[model samples]
Target: MSTAVVPGIEEIARVQGRTVRVLAAGQVLGGVSFGATVSLGALLAADLSGEESLSGFATAAVTLGAALCAIPLARLAGVRGRRFALTLGNAFALAGIAIVILSAALRLFPLLLAGVILIGAGNAGNLQSRFAATDLATPRRRGRDLGTVVWATTVGGVLGPLMITPGEALGAVVGMPPLTGAYLFSIVAQVAALVLYLVALRPDPLALAQRIALSAGPSGPVVESDRPVAARYAMLAVAASHVVMASVMAMTPIHLSHIAHAAHGGHAVETTEITLLVGTTIALHVLGMYGASPLFGWLADRIGRVTTILAGLGILTLALGTLTLWPDEQPAVVVGLFLLGLGWSAGTVAGSALLTESTPIARRPRRQGLSDTTMTASAAVGSVLAGIVLGGPGYGALALIALAIVAVTALLSPLGRR
Candidate 1:
């Protein structure tokens, strides 16, 4: 018979508040690095490979790396706790950034891919931190807590792309390749995140939750019934949404550059204009992704996860439809991308909250890890195919394809009355 050692509700709430604050701070800094990398990774790949066709490889590598690392990190969290796993993930990102700098200096495409893969591992940690927020949360507040952490990323995500021109200038001052300078900023940002995680994430939320549950006796906390089915549905929804978002997002910069050049009568587009367009578009998209998460979370808790997911699909369809109608138009592209981010935000937050609610406490981390792995792996495949489609039938066709996928996801959703 296990003795009950449950902490008081007020104590639990206090710890939860502290945990979220620390996680949010780390996420902000981590977001800076990730946002900058997202803006530059594909461009750097195209430049290094000397083939626009391979542009997707960089994003794909990052997603694939995230996929590869997700399970291991989750297992580590399961065994050692969230702090250990998060710290290790940041370390991998730091090392990867270093290698990326070296690869850029030497103009080695393979090495660059290797380094990006490590950065992806770090992303796995960053992504998992949102879930960590839910470990000690009351069932009623799970979505809201998750949303707060996701929303925190907005600060860094918005600032990241705006740093590109300055990052290049910094590179020039340091006698480094322009494209490589972002990694320098990334290195510093990741180090700060790693240190924050190591020093501040106290009481180890997962371990604490586990102890509290065990203290409740052999019956444990009341877990949801039909968890397996709900878990499967949640995973599918999250993965499908991620595929749509990553496929289009991964190809956006390349598309923007091509159209800009064509509009200029086959001459290279001015760097300043390209930076302005891409940076502004990406900044807005990130805003859409993170800014509305709180509302979506509240909706998830109030309306239901399935309804939130269906709403996300509707928004995604609208986004894809807009892109299909106005393929190369900058304003339309910006609107579509922003909608895309918004839709993804809805699907991801709702689906993740549902997954957490549905799974058994002891098994939550593993299932969450599996969900992330599937999401990123599908995203990797979508990204690679996106490159092929964009290079062949063009952006209009790509939008049509994404729209079709959204339709299929809707049809397959488990939301209908059973």
Candidate 2:
């Protein structure tokens, strides 16, 4: 009986490992798809109209979709469980990719936007992957697990732009025009992600969490969860960090375009170099976002989440200030962008850990969804505002605005103090 029990326990452990690996793979693939979509949007628009604004719109559409769906999707997962909720998200991605591919083939920009919206809905699901990791982890290792999943995203994200070259190559052989094949690649990635999620995420994490909660029969010296001041401050910090990150990151290509124009004596710039620069910066930004997540997550678990949050905001302050001073220098600009990515990763990991630890498990999903919604919504607003600001007040004013928001975050951090 003892021998049999030992084998059974080992099997269970093995199965759980498989489940986590599958979930990780799903997240990684999702990251690849998101990166591909972001990387390809400008190229797609350039093919269609050469209007920079259309690319911005395409990017914003995805954020809007995530902002709209974040809470609802979280609630759905909370009630139904991870398997069904994640599967639903993958389905949306699959369909969205299909629509995008079809739109590209047919040369329809509006339909492409709709497809992006659908993909954004899928992104909402992908963003929750960290939370899903938390649900399965022991409290002591929760941050590490969450960070590990995030780190996996960097792996696929780095590869996403490379996929575009292959996509274009395939397009050449298939005769689907220039950039239409990239969307087709997106469809394949999304579908593969869906399959990975279905096959690997076997025991639904939400359901497992519910079972664990039931067995633990909670009773502890829980902090008072009714502090509206702290919650609101936390929300603001999250939103501002996101806004700064998005505004600066999203506007990079526009900045590079201006640089190219200036180089050419104030005329419209060449295409290939601009594309390469944008692609490279985005990939670097993604690397910055995920590379240090594990370290930050571990820090949040030990040194207090609020302190980490403040530190992240301070990093953003430095990053934005650097950009303001050296707006025209490419190396400086790229380094500043990397700092923005690092700042965002720190804030997001710490903020999420704080929110999770502060709330009850039963209400975790709803609150998490709300936080994500606010973050994404603010980012959408920032992207649009960045375009306007870039055209008018330019990078100097934008960097100053980001600094002011960081100052606000610093002021609010005291609310979480005991």
Show the colliding residue pairs in model 1: none
Clashes of 2: 0
lDDT tens readout by residue for model 2, 1-418: 0111112334434544666677778877787788877777645654564566545666677788789889989999898877777778888887887787777778888888788788888988988887887765555666667777777888777667556666667877888766556566667767888787777786676666555454433322122244445666666777778888877776676777777778789987655566567667778888888888888888877887789888898889888989999987787788888898889888887777666666667777888899889988888777777767777788767888888888988887887653
Largest TM-score belongs to which candidate?
A: 1
10 residues in a row with least lDDT, candidate 1:
216-225
Model 2 segments more than 4 A misplaced: 1-19, 42-50, 216-231, 266-270
lDDT of each: 0.87, 0.74
TM-score of 2: 0.88
Model 1: per-residue Cα lDDT over 1-418, one tens digit each: 2335766777888999999999999989988888887888888899888998899998898999999999999989988999999999999899888888888889999998999999899999999988999888877788888888999998888778777778877888989875776667787889999999999999888887777766744423324334777778888889988999989988998999987998899997777677667777888888888889889988988898889989999999999999999999988999999999999999999999889888877898899999999999999889999999999999889989989878987887774212
TM-score of each: 0.96, 0.88
